[model samples]
Structures are given as C-alpha cells and as structure tokens.
Target: MISLVILSFTVKKNYTSASTNSFTKTINTIVIDAGHGFRCENGCRHGSTGENITEDQVSYEVSKRIVAELKKKYPSVKIIESRPTPFFVENRARAEFANKNKGDLFVSIHCNFVPKIRDVRREGTRTETKYVYVGKGKKRKKVKKTITVPVYKTYYLPNPAHGTETYVFAAHKTDDKEEIIMENGDIFENEKDDSTINNNINDPLIKQQVALWTKQFFANSVKLASMMEEEFTTLGRFSRGVKQRQKGIWVLQATAMPSILIELGFLSNSEEEAYLLSEPGQQQMAESIVKAISRYKELVEKGAPQPPVNNGKR
Candidate 1:
C-alpha cells in the first residue's frame, strides 16, 4: 500500500491575503499525466487490463491526443507530459515534474477497471465410485458404490459497470495538500525574492498562508473536475460525476496546482473497452477535455467567480 506523509502545523493568524492572492490570471503551463505504465519483470505496477487492452495503453493514447488538441487550440499554452513513453514513473516523480515546470493546471488521464464477475453453471452429471461402511463396528464391511454427481463449470464474465468520473483531492487530506504547497512554495510565489514561503515555513503566519492557499487550490480543482464531467455528459457518455477518494491519490494532492484525475471508462466492460480502443472514441474524449480546459482558462483569466459545482448529473 502507498503511504502518505502528513505534517502538522499551527495557524496563529487568519491570513486573508492568501485567499485574495491569485497564482496567475492566465494559465501558461499545463501538465498532462498518463496514468500507470508497462509492468516490470517483478510483476508490479501493472495497470488494469481487459479484452487484451491495458489501461496504460489507453491513457497514453488519450494523453497524446489531448496534448495535440490543446496545442492546436491554444498555441500559447505550454504543455508538459509526465510520461511521454510507456515506462513506469513513480508518483513522486510525476508530481515533481509538474512542480519543477511550474504548471498552472494538472490533468491525469486514466481508464477505470473492475474485476470480472464469476459465472457458474451445472453442465451435466458424472458417475463416481466411493467406498462406504455397510455394517456396525465389529461386523462392518467396506463396499464400493457408484454415484452420480452434478458437474459445475465456472467462467469469468466482464463486469457491467461503465462510466466516466473525475476526482479531486479529498477535502479531509488538506494537510497533505498544505505540505505539498509548502515544499514547492516557489511555484505559488507571486514574486521571485529572498523572502519566499519556503524560507519561513516554520512561522505561524506562513503556515496560515499555506492553509488558505490549499483551500483555493481545492476549490479550483473541484471547479475543473465538474467542468470535465459536464463535457463528458454532453458527449452522451455516462457521467459518474465528480468524486473524492477517501484514500488520497498521491499525484492529485502532491501536485502544487489545480489537479484532477479522470476515469474515462471501465476497461473490464467489453463495450467500453472497445470504445476506448477505437480511433474516433479517443479523439472525442480528447476534444471534450480540451473544450473544458478552454472554458476554465477563460473563466480564470477573466477573474470571474467560478460557478458553484452541482452534482454534475445529466
């Protein structure tokens, strides 16, 4: 199991300035993370697979198309990919890349999966021979008897669950979010100077600032996630809506920006797997993501208050 490191900090003063302080009016850099990667020889880190298709394969393809579409639509925006190849990258490394690049937004693409359901049926009956005692203890005798038993065959069928959902960092994991912000304070700094937040992390005032900034990041993450799910719904795809995992996702909370992880569809479902593996399906998914980002960019740059996120159901 993956472990999260949580840090404790005390806030003495209410830093209202942190709330008003905006990271940037315009989003200049966006990070695209293709979830999972090829399995190693040690039989670890392999992502979900079904119908001979792997989650890494689908995510990588979709991420590449998203990059292409975003570049075409918004030429000025800089795009960085966490995994440009199929090789496995640690969660820490992916977050580090986004932080080092000073990404304004982070999007991680992935396919969902559930275990196959077991299906059992009685095929036919067969004859079996067994030994049985025919009498009492002293006079007991072993006898061979023939009996018929039902034969059952078990097989696995694809799971029926299919849909798209978006995930932001769980609200309860704000401490982890604050820790990430403090560690990469430079990314959130408005000005490049000697008095950066990193220099005074131990100060109560600095801790308060980090806490407020984390709140802002969380709100923005929810807004972006809702928008992505809306786009998916518009395409007539089943939208599972925006969600927060009780167990924190490392890459989502560790990135020092508005971040989201998208579950495109379930690979264990044969129909959805076929759709995800098709050319047009990949293009459609990529276009929907780009459209959402375009709208999010406009809203943030205009300094407009984001619309309240609803349940995101159609």
Candidate 2:
C-alpha cells in the first residue's frame, strides 16, 4: 500500500518589526481575491472536450472556503473578499481594493488557461490568430488523453500547465528583514550552524535571514500544496510542484504582506477539469488550504524559521 507522508513542524512566535509581541505583528488583515472574470460568458471550457466551467465560479468556490476557515480562527481579523458572487471583476479593481483597505496580505486565486492558435479569414487576409476556447457539448463523456492533430494552419496552442504555484513580488530594494540578517550572526549563531549559514543562497547575513524567512514560507506552502495535490490526485487532479515566482502580480505587489498564489490545477487538463468542476473536488481543495494556513500559524508560534521542520518522525 502507498502511504502519504507529510512533514510538519511547529514554528515559534515571530516578533513584529517594532519589537512587539508575535501576536501584535502577525497580520490581522487578509484580502482574498477570487480572480478576474473572463468577459466572454457561458463559462470556459474543460480543454477540447467542450465541457463548460466558469472562471468566476471556480474562484468563488475556493475563496469562500478560505475565508470561512480564516474567520473561524481570526475572529477579530479583518477579511476582505474581492468577489463573493459569480460576477465580473477587473484586475485593477482587485488591486485597488487591497491598496485602499491597507490590507496586510493579498492572495489572488486563479485558474490557468492556454489558448489555441487558429487561422482567421479576416478581411480576406488568411492570417493566424491565437484563439482557443473551451465549450460545452450536448452530453458529457469520459475525458480523453490524446494529442489533437491539426491540418493546414491549424496551430495547436500548448495546453495550460497545471499544479500549485506560490509567487512573491520581486523586491525593488533590500527589505528591512534582509538588512538585519546581514549585520548580525551573533544573535542567531547559537540557533544555526556555520555550514547552515554558509549554505544560504544569497550568503549576505541580511539576505540570508530573508531567505530563511522565505524558506519557511515555502515550507508551509509545500505542505498545503502536498495536501491539495494528494486529495486532488486521487480525484484525478494534476500534481504541479509548489514553486516560487518573483514576477510582480498585481495582488502580490500591492499588499504589504508576504503573499503567494496557489494555482490548484489546470482547467485544460481533461481529467483534472472534470474533477475540479465537481463539488467534492472543491471541498477537498478548500480543506487542503485551511490545513496549510493553520499549520503556518502553528509554525510561526514555534520559532522554527530556518531549517525544515525537524520533528522526531521522518
């Protein structure tokens, strides 16, 4: 029998920047973005299968659960949701909401899409245009796993890759945490060894500390990603590894908090698409996220920032 092994560690409470208590610094405001609406309606497709699923619908389902879980724990915490219903919202509006509210962290949830390229007979000019769409058919059938064969100028746009991803906005300049990690080793030398310190990618003490913090962030993210992937996998979800992207996503850049985007799976994957559109799949996805967030809070309380969670078990 195959066993799923999940590694978790308790993190010590982290003090805020002002040297206040960990509880004081911990972010109390969270902005949950359910992604932008695809202007074209009737819902998006599940790849070439013609199974229809709306982007707005998926976002709402995932965000609702995240909000519910957060509210349960952080009752006093402020929660701002971009869209609670199946409505069209723009990217700019999403960014502005987080900014105006002074939200500490902004997490924008979205599904990935890869369009197909096809020929267009516009104005008698037979030029190629990139336009791929998913549509619903009269009846639903089992999803097929095969490549589409195109003739003539029927360019096949690659399918959108799925799996989970967490992105942090690129830093324009050094952050305060990075600056501190650079100036001092005496403060943390007792907790971490020289080889461990030297192994830091940036090597700068300040950068190292930031790296350590980010690593901790990724650690928590991975746990959540794993949980989601596992549940989704059994239900036919894709297994995209948890990765960090430094590009500036509007939500990631606008918030003052450390945030990442979790791409649950691709709508283009026939098998995964069907699973995601189902009710059971959405619940599992939400539960995975809640577990990850709860675990992160627990880690922060334990002060286990640098190394992987070293619990007694493997």
Candidate 3:
C-alpha cells in the first residue's frame, strides 16, 4: 500500500496501474439490481429456465427480500433496487439510474443454472424377452415363458450443476468499461470539463487517474465479493469461488462504482430450486449478504489496505 501511494506521485502518467485515488470513499448508498427482469423483446434479457422456477422470478424475489433485510439492518444506509417488480429493466438503464443517483456500490442479484442439455447423456437397463421351446415328459410343445435380461445404454443428459459464485468485471474489458464510466450518463460528453473529467483525450494524466480509480474499485469489488463467498460458504453452500466474467453481463462494467454480481445458486438443480423458492432459504441468503456488506463497510471505511490484484480473464 505504501509503495502504491509512492508510485502514484512518482510514476509516469502512462503507467496506469500504479496510481490510485488519494482518498477512500465511504459507501452511503447501494444500488441493487435484479437480473433478467426484461425479455429480449422488451429490451434486456438475461436468464435461465429451471426445473421448477425461472431466473427472472428468483432474482426479483431474492433482491426484494435482500432490500428488506438491508433496511432492517442498516437503517441509515439508503438502498435502492433496480427493479422492485418483474418489469423489464434494461441493463444500461439500471447503470444509468445508479450513476444518476450517485450510488456508491452496485450489487446485482442473479441465479445460475446449467442450461438444459438437448444432447443428453443417458444410461439405463433395457428390457429383453426371448422365446424358447423346451419340453420333457411325454410330449414336447412350445410353451409361453418370459425372461428378463440386463441391458445398458449410454447417451447425453442435462447438466445438473449447482453452486454459488461471485463476479467482478474482467481486465480485457477494461477499456470498454472505462469508456462507459467516462462517457455513459454523467461520465462524459455531458459532464463539464473539470479537474476530474477531462475533454483532452490525449492528456493521459486524468485518464490514468480514472483508470487507477477503476482499478482500485475493481479491487474493492473483489474484497466484498470474497467476503460474500466466505459468508455463503459458512452457510453450507457450495462456494464456486469469485469469478471475473467479461461477456454478457454489462451493468457492472458501466456503473461508476465498485460492483459485484452474486449468483445465488443453480435453479436447474431441483433441490436448490426448491430451497431458493422457500421463505427460509431466501431469508438466510439475504441475511448473509447483508452481513457481508456490514463487514465490508467496517473494513473499507476504516481504510484497510488494498487487496492484492487477482483479476481473471474468464
């Protein structure tokens, strides 16, 4: 951390990763996004079908309950959900709303499921019957007999994967995300050129500064995500480890704040689907997330050291 601070002042402007924000901003408002509220026809579409539930439904339910829990636990903290109902909400719209409201943190709630496989692998015993003639005594005659034989089969099957995962933006998408932060909504174009926002694209100083801030914010997002995984693991859920996804998910990258996307569990798994739809399971997950946020707030607000970089490509 000390070395990082030294590099911020002494390093060349083109060296983007070394510099960092001079101050640690406290999180006062958090924007919660429920994944897959909209269909492709409506604008935003991100979801998977489960055995008994849908991603859009589960995400909205979980997000609504999490908001309830957050309100109960942190009365002073302002909480906003990108979608309170199952209405269509575009990803860009969600990001724009959070940015317009000056949200400090963005949390996207979603459910993960292995897509049902059309090329399914199968294995089972097949029934076989054979007719044979056997007689001993005075006369031999064809007799009716049924016999069962063991058989085997092999084929493809639907994936039954289940787990919990957390994600931050990937590094390869840094430039695109930086552009979003720079030009999306209040990021640029409309923002008046000041010491913070610079119109001169050639001047690498402010660009570097913004880059450093986003890098550190990415670091903080990892910290919070790790804490969340730990909390979920403690609750006896399978921890798929924190992930870095570059494709498909856009809201996290566009927002001008530290962000994370939580994959609660696989809806494709029957047991997990039932659990996620239950009152008890939803309450527990919401509480665990709130606890993780509380811990993150305590540590980050106290100016903890920047977490070591562990960005991944996938």
Best by TM-score: 1
Per-residue lDDT of 1-314 in model 1, one digit per residue for the tens?
Answer: 00001111112212433345553245778999999998676655568887768999899999999999999887878888999998778899999998888788999999999998899999999999999889998999999999999999999886789999999999998999889888875553443322344567877777776777688788888889999999999999999999999998999989977899999999988888999999999999999999999888887777532322333531
Give me the candidate number with maximum lDDT. 1
* Selected candidate, larger lDDT, 2 vs 3: 3
Name the Cα RMSD for model 3: 9.9
Of candidates 3 and 2, the better by TM-score: 3
**Which regions of candidate 3 fall more than 4 Å away from where they truly are?**
1-23, 38-46, 116-158, 184-202, 246-248, 304-314
Ten-residue segment with the worst summed lDDT in candidate 2? 1-10
How close to the true structure is residue 29 of candidate 1, measured as C-alpha lDDT?
A: 86
lDDT of 3 by residue, 107-222 (tens): 99999887666553445545656666787777767776666555545455656788899998887777766776556323333323222333443456656665776787788889
Q: For candidate 2, write residues 1-314 as lDDT tens digits.
A: 00000011111222122222232124446778887554456564321221467555677788888899788877877888876665667666776666555454556677765555454332333334444444568554445344444344345554556665444444432243234233322223334323244344253443433545444433443444455445545555556655545444555543433455766666666555776688877778777666665555554446522444555542
lDDT of 3 at 248: 37
As a whole number from 0 to 100, the lDDT of residue 92 in candidate 2 is 62
Model 2 misplacement above 4 A: 1-24, 38-50, 116-160, 171-237, 244-247, 302-314
Q: Any runs in candidate 1 off by more than 4 Å, and if so which? A: 1-24, 39-45, 188-196, 304-314
The C-alpha RMSD of each candidate to the native structure, in angstroms, is 8.3, 17.3, 9.9
Candidate 3: residue 250 Cα off by (Å): 0.8
